[model samples]
Target: MTLLKAKSILSKDFRIGRASDRLFGSFVEHMGSVVYNGIYEPDHEAADEDGFRKDVLELVRELKLSVVRYPGGNFSSGYNWEDGVGPKERRPVKLDLAWRQVEPNSFGLDEFMRWTGKVGADAIMTVNLGTRGIDEARNLLEYCNFPGGSQYSDLRRSHGVRDPYKIKTWCLGNELDGEWQIARKTADEYGRLACETAKAMKWVDPDIELVAVGSSARHMPTFPEWDRTVLMHTYEHVEQLSLHHYIGKRENDTPTFLAMPLEMEQQIKDVIATCDYVQSVKRSSKRMKLSFDEWNVWREPDVPYTPWQTGCPYDWVKFHMEDALVFGSALLSILRHADRIDIACQSLLVNTIPMILTNKGGAAWRNPTFYPFLHASRYGRGEVLRLETESPKYDTKLYTDVAKVDSVAVWNEEKGELTVFAVNRSEESIAYELDIRDFGNVSFAEHLVMNHERLDAVNTADNQGEVRPRAGGTTTLNGGRAESVLPPYSWNVVRFNVQSA
Candidate 1:
């Protein structure tokens, strides 16, 4: 077998931007077992004092998530924040129209906040802009952030806590442009409502940053226009605009599926262009950032679940090794645009196409997709270095001249470390070279690779280690240059310790 060749030139001076810790975020929605058996299970053997699963929390802590979006996805659009605050017994049990399930309200705002605190992550709360509006949004803001004296603040104080939650980041709404959304709005209508809600919420707590809803996905007919119109209205009030993308295999087309991140990269660029267009239109100097809050590989058909049942098993699709490759590439795409994208949450943290899966009263296991996220969250921090690469290219059904090797580099200036994340999209091993420049003396530290012969390999509760990362790949560094062999259909992490000459 012949080896494909790839090389990337990296310099210390060339930088994209300092990667935001919030970029390594995850989402937790009230949908399905994501909230119930997913994270909160009182009967679980590993239950904590707060009723959150200690086993799950251990995994979450290991993931090193910086921030978590709460009570949402589509659920925030129809949810009433008030219902989720008070005592558990008094909390109302309502039908979740969004996902066609019952919401017991047992795990509400306070519980979520506590859970986030325990896991050492900040909260990005979303308000209900579909079934509700400005007043409710401001009230929820007041309840969470206000110190005291106001009705909502005092109400929060009466619950048990005297201190304010003071969550700084917020999402104005979910995907309101989708027809499936509870109160799906026209672009103009959503723009107006979002602007007003943002204004009122800011009036209540000026410190909070707002993320206005953008189009649900790039394929939405209203796409760039929807983002433009929304930004046109909410530009001054909000700090970031939200974008969601979920990649999946189409007709067993692995090449096409892996190339989907190219689409994701373009979507980020298009949204940035839209934001700039809106900025010019408004003549506003404030540049709008983006929050890619909902993203993952979701391709499972809807599974059957009893209606109105608590902790119903839903969307428990086990991710395969092929899925992890796409997931890793998608993450690299996000990292490449770290300058403009402020926050990103991999859809659901626990079940529902998640990195981790849990049984109702059994064990919690890592999915194949977990390793890429884990590697990125752990080492893919600090400055994103600009890499000029030349790699062997191949043509896919949907993409032309697709690079066999896709890669990105991150330099942790403080830690004196430079890390390179690369993916081999081809079925053959690639001889890769790192053309290090400008940085002083450096030595290869480690190389972690994830590769499995079976693309459909998955980890179950019984065999938790069916698919995982291993220390492999031959890498050596000498005189500001490194050489490594990337395995076929693999995700590789190459780290180097930078030293001053």
Candidate 2:
């Protein structure tokens, strides 16, 4: 009889307790339905008394989003804050060059703040470092943070918001390294502009936090140089050095593909080192952190950009299952380094590669990738525990000798629960023993699993329930340990309870 060798994982090492848990922070932008129908569909049946969709709000709360980046991805670079404020009736209609849509100006600045308040999440505002600069940024600070008698603050008062928005975290720009970015600037030009703009903004609201743009991607030809140049020039001017990284499933191979997340793990280390290097060069005591502003799974080959002649409003691309798995991997990486990355936005919150998407007006449903995002945000807080696991390597086109299962566990100290988030990207079903050694006096709780029949499965307006989360199977609890069954191509979160002995 042939004997099957168990996928043995020895739980023996205790490395660094945690890196960071900023995976809680996600992003939202005003492109496509993200603003129009994604969150603010006036025609939705589930909209609340304030015209905000109750279904979406409930979902966001369920996801337990900590921070939602607002206003723009590329859209902010060209946005006019004044145009969006004041009486809606008197608001001017303008062209949205970034998304190629008509900016009705009805749902601008104040409307977003109102929605943020409704969702019960902190706001991360990105300034227009691209088209507009210092003056507009200062006015925005006044409008959102300053007290009475000021022009912008008075405008905020006239608009019915008596209290200031006081959004503490702010981003300087979105993907300024890419030439495709609206009003793209050279590194030198951007550095000077950001320096000036940040100085002026700090003068307005000294307490506010600022993020300077980093490289769009390390793979870009002008990478480390762009990052160094920008940081060298703007690090002292801001609190956080922004880093934007995205991963996509271009290759059909799952093994190497799942390794993308760990690649990002290395990415953050490099970014931290970069921040330190620049800080050392300046001999500055102020330690700058990272704001991973924009990140997600975007493969240009998968979703071919619609020609502008077709009037494709702002690169609107829906997400897929494999893409979501890659996203899951990305979250694990971010959680692993939460210490240096205090503030991070998930690029966008809706429709355009959005974590949550809505269709049929106000009726929202979870995307296949949404479950990983939901689980990570919901359970991934407190000090992250460095879990030790061993999975056989799978060779693929993108990465060599990548582990089949990618997982990260977060221990919510307050709740006394150890949440293990695992992803099995192997082609065959496998089970692994989860050894909770040394630390005992606990029991297994609920295990939530999200898996679909096909890798390409997705949710749509007509059939939103096609790729949702469901139970995988019963979990096994042993002496201070548990055994988990990981189905092929699945993402699962297991909850464990450990009481004081």
Candidate 3:
């Protein structure tokens, strides 16, 4: 009977909250082929009129991304925002130590803004809190958002941008604690600098929002202390505290790797406590949120580093099938924490550990992770509903046997539908029956599954259709529950027409 069974959840009210309120966004850095060929492939057939790849743009648009963090991951630590502002031909070339690549200075601030505009998203710009300090940050703010007057604003106008970008979201720094990070600073140093910088940047544009650096990851030895100290210094000055965490499937065990999102839940919980603690200590009622700026299932098997080698830092790293499954779990985890995680960007947008990868002079394809992101971003809006599932488990050395079922339900108040994204990590398929008590009656539309036989299957530019999310089957129901078979190692999205249900 395929071990199918029904589990009645008596008080099964949907854990309804805004998923978009939690948000889905991505970052794009200057390293690797992310530039030059990734997002800016001029010679490709898919290239748009502005030189941005049309194929990649369509994929990004499909991801339903609300925000796009610009021009830096680690790149911001060393970037000087002014170099690429004026006439393109007059810009000066410089060395970008973050990625060990030469800065052509062709695709600068203006280009990035235009790209964000084309992508139908808002820009989340990062300030160089490293080598360049407050004055540089303020100048960039005035240049992008200031209307006129002063040298920088006038230079922006002379550059033909009559209007200021006025980007309101700003990141104070990117991973300031890492030794590899350019101009890394001590917690105290970063704290003082952040406070002063936030204060000054606000002076330039008070409407702008600021984020302070949280620990690079939870395991960082300085962790809670770093967060406490930074918040102590800058809590009152900033609106959000940024956290960056990345997971990997290095174990080669699908179940354990899929368990990562649940683990991330714990880490996010800790960060939340830390923030509340700081808020309590400072005796401030104003709540602060989290920005998970860098995240995703990155498959960088190994790092072969030759200090400042004469080559790009990221050469040809791309994501595969299983990686995307893990990515779905990560997005599910983000939904679970929708209330506190105010801003989240999928590590990157194009190339350099991106959600979308492109090849110059050829077509580009969506990474295996793209479908999950696309499905959820397009439908994971409105109120997020909490789901409860029970299944058999498997044990691994790192983490014990985990539940085979994981799910996040989104109730789109705007569209009046419910999308239940479930990741069945079990090796064997399981037919499950669900009853959503909140929706007394509704119709199930589709059950799309992102699955394939080989764990390593990938999408290439030539055979882009080799892997993708295809239309799923669903019951034309007039009932109170939803039923579906969640395939092994797959992510499933069950869409329900629950407008008034």
Candidate 4:
């Protein structure tokens, strides 16, 4: 097979920005088994004192998540924070109209905070804005962040939580623009409500950062217009705007599927443009950041369950190797825009299209998507180095000049390390070259690759290692230059120790 060629140059002076730790965030919603058998199962043999599954916790810890958005997605729109607090027995059981499931109220506010503490992640709490508005939003903020003296704070103390949870990040609401959302609102309505709710919540706890709801998906008919209107209304009050998107395979086209990140990258740039436009309109110096709080490769499951069933099994997708490649490329897209995207959460952390899956009373296992997220979360930190690349290109039905090699680099000054993340989208191996400049002497560490002969290969509880990453790829470094042969249809991570001459 003839080798395709790709070259990239990286220098210390060319930096986008320091990657935010919160860029490695993941989300956990009260949908499906994600809350019940997924993370909190009392009867499991590996269950901890708090009823959280220790085996699952072990996997979550490995991801090194910076923040875990709690009790939401669409769930928060209809959620009543009061329903999930105090004693588990006394808490009210309600019909969750979001996913058409019954919420037992067994695990609520306090439980999620404790779970985040156990996993060593900060909480990005979402308040109810659909069914309830500013009052309920402020009340939940007080319940979580206030140090007594008020009704909600005293109520929290009465529940045996003496000190406040002090959650620093707050999402005003979830996708309120989607018609599928429980009390979905128009852009004007959501913006006014989000703005006022942000005001009251900050009044309750002045230290919290607020994220206003932007367009739920890029293809929404109201897209950039919705974002613009919402920002125009709430820009002064909020710190960040929220965006959610999910990509999936299209008609068995592997090349087009791998090129999906082009869409993602474009969407990020468009949203940033809208935010900046809003800033220019207001003539304000406050530049708004973004929270890509919900993102993943979602393929709706064929699995079925009766309506109103508590802890119902739903949308448990076993991701394949091809999915992981696209997923890792999506991470690279996010890393490339680290200056604007301050926070990102892979939606539904367990069971419902998650990285890790658990068998009700049995074992916990990883999906093929787990390893890419693991590698990115573990090594894709520090300053993002902008790379200039030249590679063989192909045109897909939706994209033109799509690079056969998708890649990004991160330079960790403190650790004296440089990490390169690359993906080979073509079915033929590529001869890759890296020209390092101004970083002085650097030594190659290891090349980790994830490639499978079968595009549809998956991992299950019984066979967890069926499609994991391994140390492979032929790579060598000399005189500030590196060369490697990237495998066909693979996800690669290369590391190097940097020293100044």
* lDDT on C-alpha atoms for all candidate structures: 0.91, 0.75, 0.78, 0.91
List TM-scores for all candidates, in order.
0.98, 0.91, 0.94, 0.98
Candidate 4, residues 161-276: lDDT per residue as tens digits?
A: 99999999999998999999989999999998988888888888888999999998999998989999999899999999998879987777889999998888999999999999
Q: Is candidate 2 or candidate 4 better by TM-score?
A: 4
RMSD of each: 1.2, 3.0, 2.4, 1.1
Regions of candidate 1 where Cα sits further than 4 Å from its true position: 301-303
Model 3's TM-score against the true structure: 0.94
- Candidate 1 differs from the real structure by a C-alpha RMSD in angstroms, to one decimal, of 1.2
In the predicted model 4, the residue pairs found to clash are none
Answer with 1 or 4, whichever has the higher lDDT: 1
**Residue 464 error for model 3, in Å?**
1.5
Query: What lDDT tens digits, residue by residue, belong to model 1 across residues 1-501?
Result: 667789999988899999999999999998889999999998888999889999999999999999999889899889999998888999999999988888889899999999999999999999999999998889999999999999999999999979999999999989999999999999899999999888888888888999999999999999999999888788998999999999878777888888888999999999999999999999889999999999998868345667678888778878889999999999999999999999999998998898999989999999999999999998899999899999998888899988889999999989988999999999899989999867877878899999999988889888999889889578987777798899999999999888866
TM-score, structure 1 vs. true: 0.98
Which candidate number maximizes lDDT? 1
Off by over 4 Å in 2: 1-22, 299-318, 360-362, 472-474
lDDT of 2 by residue, 401-481 (tens): 677777777766577777778777776666766777555676888888777778778777678878777765557878866
Q: Deviation in angstroms for 152 in model 3?
A: 1.7
lDDT of 3 by residue, 374-483 (tens): 88777887777666666676677677757677777777756767677877777677666677656665677888887788877888767776667767644334357656
Query: Lowest lDDT 10-mer window, candidate 2?
Result: 3-12
Error at 454, model 2, angstroms? 1.7
